[model samples]
Target chain A: MRVLGVDPGLTRCGLGVVDGAPGRPLRMAAVGVVRTAADDGVGARLVAIERGIEAWLDEHRPEAVAVERVFSQHNVRTVMGTAQASAVAILCASRRGLPVHLHTPSEVKAAVTGSGRADKAQVGAMVTRLLRLDAPPKPADAADALALAICHIWRGTATGRLQQAVAAHAHPRG
Target chain B: MRVLGVDPGLTRCGLGVVDGAPGRPLRMAAVGVVRTAADDGVGARLVAIERGIEAWLDEHRPEAVAVERVFSQHNVRTVMGTAQASAVAILCASRRGLPVHLHTPSEVKAAVTGSGRADKAQVGAMVTRLLRLDAPPKPADAADALALAICHIWRGTATGRLQQAVAAHAHPRG
Candidate 1:
């Protein structure tokens, strides 16, 4: 399955696409950041971010989109912007009928580094290793985005399998 | 000038349109709420809000849009939704080239009732009095929306005049 992951922020929104599924090697399709001027009005900044996300969707054509779920408990000032940016990402993908999933920061960290409390350097190192890239993605945000996609793919596949198993047990084989 | 005020929330987004100027009576063009089911995902709710705001813009054709500025310091859990909803409102209006202004809750209350800390009922009563309505708009959010519009009109007009005056002084008309 192909998935686009978004590490949402008002100043620099990270975007990464990955193609992978259970027992398959992951491949990085693209990685980039969508930036908006801090001096711009909030509305104009949001519009710019929207356009950027739209361009990514048109180019990558991912089957599903995963966004980092923002917690209000984060930085009191920055959390609002993070939530707003994530909303834009989710809206863009879901409006196109693509499945949208939200993963917490801890979930992404644990999925790749086996530790929810892993530092940025650790997460970046693992993303580089998993994607087989010579170097980590330039910005930490981009690496986080890749990790989000990885988490979604792994978790979603396992959840799907678990559901199938439950269904089979309930009905028995025909 | 005609202005649309949006009191944004995840479940209940209040909308109000008012027509007025600095020295004239205010008229209530319209008032309503856009509601989303509690069970719907955040992205879906945001899309619904965008559509609702678009319809209001199409019908009212307000020259400007005024939205309540969300503060992250507010209720932790609810503030994120409010910020996201406000983003949708701002995006919809600004995309169409309408001037979008954000007024703080205190600013709206002060404009309507001459007090920054005015209670909701006080603000509602003033909205009813200013718009010459028989009753205050139902749902405090709706009244708060009208207050936002009223604040935008009064404050915006004054700001424009101040800027014009400064320009006139600098240029010195013959």
Candidate 2:
């Protein structure tokens, strides 16, 4: 399955598409950052991010989209902006009828590096090795995005199947 | 000017449209809540909100859209949902090239009830009186939405003009 992961932010939104499944060789379809200036109005910045995500969705056409869930931060303003950007990414995917998954930072870290407390450098290095790339994706955000995609591919599919199993058990067909 | 105000929330997003200038009698054009099921996925909830906001914008065609600025709350999840919903409102307005304004709770309370710390009852009473409604809007969210629109009508226009003045002074055309 191809999954597009989004590291949502107001100033720089990271996006990466990965094609693969659990226990398989994963490949990077695309990776980039969508940047919005600090001076731009919040609405305008959101619009720009929306357009950028729309373009990526059109270009890569990933089967599922994974977005980083915005958790509470000390900086309320920053968290608000990040949450806003995250919502825009989810909206883009929903408009296209794509299933969207949200993964916490710790979840992505654990999935990629086998450690929830892994640092950025460790995660980046593991992503490079896993994708068999010469170097890690430029900008920490890009690497984080790739990690998210990988994590969702590894975890989301299993979770979906489990949910389906539960549903089927609850309402069995005759 | 006509303004559409949004009181962003996950379960019940309040939307209201009001028409008038700062000193004139304001008229209510529309008021309602966009409800989403709590059990729904976040992406589906956001998509529903987007569609609701789009419909409001298309029907009301307000000159500007006003959204409640999300404030830091003790409940992180609740705040995140509110911020996400607020972003959808802004995005809908931005897509339509309509100006978007964000008003704080204090700002709305002050504009509607003459006190920033006024309680919901006070604000609701003031909104009913200001809009000349037969009764206060059913839900508190709806009343808050109307208050936001009134606040923007009374304050946002003046703020916009002041911003224009500052910009023109910073960069003179001649």
Candidate 3:
């Protein structure tokens, strides 16, 4: 399956496309970032992101899209931006009738590195080795995006329990 | 000027439309909520919100849009959903090149009532009075959405200072 993974952020949204099956060798189709000026209004930045994501979707035409699930981190403000950016990516994919899936950071790390607690460098190294690239993708965010796609490819479809877990993460009453 | 106010949430997204200029009394164009099932995935929920907001835009043709600014509340999960839902609203409005503005909870309360710390009942009472409605809008979310539209009308365009405040709220380094 061809999958597009998006590591969403207001300032720099990472985009990566990958072609692979569960047991087949993976190929990197495209990888990049959608950046917005920090000084721009949230609305304007979101519009730019939408345009960028739409452009990538038009170009790659991936069968499925994977987005990094955002979590509440130490930085509350940054988390909000991440959530908003992820929303834009999800909106673009779902609007196109494409299947959208979200994988948590640890899930991606475990898929790539065999350890849920793997650090950035470890995940980056695994992604490079698995993709057979000259070097790891730049800006860490790009590598993370590829890892998300890879993770999604390995996991295949989300099960009912996984969907419930997602709901529980986003909804207090879930 | 007509304004569409969006009080964004995952479970129940409140949408309120108002028509008025600075000096004239405001008219209630429409008021409703776009309800989504909690069991649905976030992507599907976001798509539903985008469709609902787009339908409102098509039916009301508001000149501008106002969305309630999401803040870091005690419930982290709920906050993420709010930010995502609000982003969908902002995306829909800005994609159409409509002027989009963000109003904080206090700002909306202050615009409709005398103080920024006004509670829900107080704001609802003032909205009913300002809109000359026989009764206040049901559901606090709907009432708050109307208050947001009223706030944007009263505050006019987001000044340079206000935009900066918005940036500061959303971005960690801003």
Candidate 4:
């Protein structure tokens, strides 16, 4: 399945698209960052991010969208901006009727590097080897986005199937 | 000026609209809550909120949109949900090219009542008195929404004008 992963942030949002499924070799379709000036107004920054995500969606048309779930941070303003950007990504996917998955940072790390405590270097190294790229994606955020897409393909798909099975078992005879 | 106030939440989002300026008497144009089932998916809940806010904007065509700034809470999940909903409200207003204002809880309270530490009952009472309504708006959320509207009319307008003046002063050619 084609999946688009978004590492949501107001200053620099990471966008990556990967085509793969469970037990299949992953391929990178695209990777980039949506950036907004720090000096821009909040509304304008959000609009820029929205337009960037929409452009990516239109070009790639991924089957599913994966977003990094916002977690508590020492800086409330930072977390709020991340959450707002994350919401924009989810909103775009939902508007297009595509299923959106939210994976925590630890979850993505564990899925990509087999260690929940893996650092940025470990994630970048693992992503490079998995995608068979000569070099890791530029900027840590882009690599993180790729890791999120890989995680969704490796873990989110399985979890989704399991939930479907449970629901079917509860109401059979379809 | 007409202002739309939004108290963003997952289950029940409060919406209120008011018409007036800083010194003139304010009139309540609309007040209500947009609710979604707790069992609903996050995407569905967000879409419901987006539609509700859009409908209100379309009907009232408010001159500005004011949202309650989300504050950090002990519950991470609750805060994330509030931030997400708040983003949707901001997105709707931004898309329509309307100016969006965010007011802190204390700021809203101070604008409505004499004290920033005013409790819910105090804020509700002040809202009732300001709108000249026979009774306070039902549900604490709705009253809070009305208070937000009233506060924006009383404070945001002046702040906006001051910003404009500063901008004009910096660039006199325009």
TM-score of chain B of each: 0.96, 0.94, 0.89, 0.94
Candidate 3's TM-score: 0.89
Q: What is every candidate's C-alpha DockQ against the true complex, given to 2 decimals?
A: 0.68, 0.80, 0.56, 0.71
Worst 10 residues of 3 chain B by lDDT: B154-163
| TM-score list, all predictions | 0.95, 0.95, 0.89, 0.95
Lowest lDDT block of 10, candidate 1 chain A:
A71-80
Where does the lowest 10-residue lDDT sum fall in candidate 3 chain A?
A155-164
> For candidate 2, lDDT tens digit of each residue in A61-164?
99999999888766887888999999999999998889998999999999999999999999999999999999999899999999999999999989988999
What are the Cα lDDT values of the candidates?
A: 0.92, 0.93, 0.91, 0.92
Candidate number of the best DockQ: 2
Candidate 2 wrong stretches, greater than 4 Å? A164-174, B164-174
Chain B structural similarity as TM-score, candidate 4? 0.94
True contacts kept of 3: 0.69
The residue ranges of model 4 lying beyond 4 angstroms of the native Cα positions read A164-174, B164-174
Q: Candidate 2 clashing pairs? A: none
Comparing to the true complex, what docking class would candidate 4 get? medium
State fnat for each of the candidate structures: 0.64, 0.80, 0.69, 0.68
Which tens-of-lDDT digit does each residue in B61-121 have in candidate 4? 9999999999775588888889999999999999889999999999999999989999999
Candidate 1: regions farther than 4 A off: A163-174, B166-174
